[model samples]
Target: MKNPVPLPAYLALCLLLLSGCAAAAGSPGSAGPPSSASSSVASPPGGAHAAHHGTETGSPAPAPAGPSEAARMVCGDQPMDRLTAILELKEKPHTVSNWADSTFTCTYHLAEGTLRISVQQAPDEASARKYFDAMQALAKDAKPIEGLANLGFPAYETADGSAVFQKDSFVLHVDASALPAVAGPNAITRNALAYQLSTTILACWVEHH
Candidate 1:
């Protein structure tokens, strides 16, 4: 079943920006416009092609694996330890919810308000991309986030301090009710914090991949 996104009020301002990402993803004619050029290789110039006639092509890279049981124990079922480290929160998350499916959710008490993080496992990359596209359709007024492009996937942070992205077969979300007045000693802003948290979770996906 397709999950309908119910974005919070703060995210309304991001709808316009993300709509394009979704549009681009769903466009049949668009395949690799924004994908990094480094990911592809150019064909060799030759008067006649002989390498393809009888040469053996190498095996493709292995398919990414699902999240590990250790990951489920560390973050999926109980994410407080991980969240606390990233947010520098004084108090651990007060709420935890592990759904009937593999969706793991946690809510933390912050100085300004609440911060919620949710992680859900999709069956495969296509399913994960479908959700990422869905979330992009719900964003507006977004700007390209710097320094996060090397995570082996497209990642973004919204103007409203929310971040959403997918890696492997996982969809990760970080939403803050309000940005902290002053980031803890480490000086991580709400948006950067979201990106950081997502990266950490994506590492888990990579480990199993």
Candidate 2:
């Protein structure tokens, strides 16, 4: 009979074989350098998948389209609800009060100047006319505003029915001069100037009366 190895020696030999097999593969004591494949295997699921992702395969998320190329976007969101604009005046409380109803924008256009006044009225030519009337009164007495420099002003009414209150949209235009040292630069101001005039005139009236 062939000589048989001792039991302990056989067990040791099995352990050595297992250890060597581990080294060949990428187990704990493996000798070969780590490969990309082995690293992926070592990595956890989510991280590896995210790292090696390709471009979106199918049905990718859509992008938002930008603003439309139009001259102006009107009424994308305008309120249907109605509101009034008010100019708080002092001395001419009754005249100012006349404007206080259903306040809205009233525009006055003149060859030399213009007036934009906020007042109350229903939506129509008639209300707009009344609003203009109130603005005219305010303009005749509008004195020197605090900040505006070198200002010479007079409130004149336009025979042309350009300035009026409307049921819906109201626009008031006024020609406010800078009172140039040379009378050179004349400009038509916007809403704020008109507002300022209205405020100043009314406030002064309030202070006086």
Write down the TM-score for model 1.
0.54
By TM-score, the best candidate is 1
Off by over 4 Å in 1: 1-79, 86-91, 98-102, 144-150
Candidate 1 lDDT over 1-209, as tens digits, reads 01022223213313322221111111111112121111111112321121123223333222224323422432342245546765566776555433323344445556667676654445445655655665565577555444424345756567667777676655677765376733666666677566555555555444434
Residue 197 displacement in candidate 2 (angstroms): 19
lDDT of 2 by residue, 117-152 (tens): 332222333333444444554443333222221112
lDDT of 2 at 123: 32
Clashes of 2: 18
Candidate 2 global Cα RMSD: 41.8
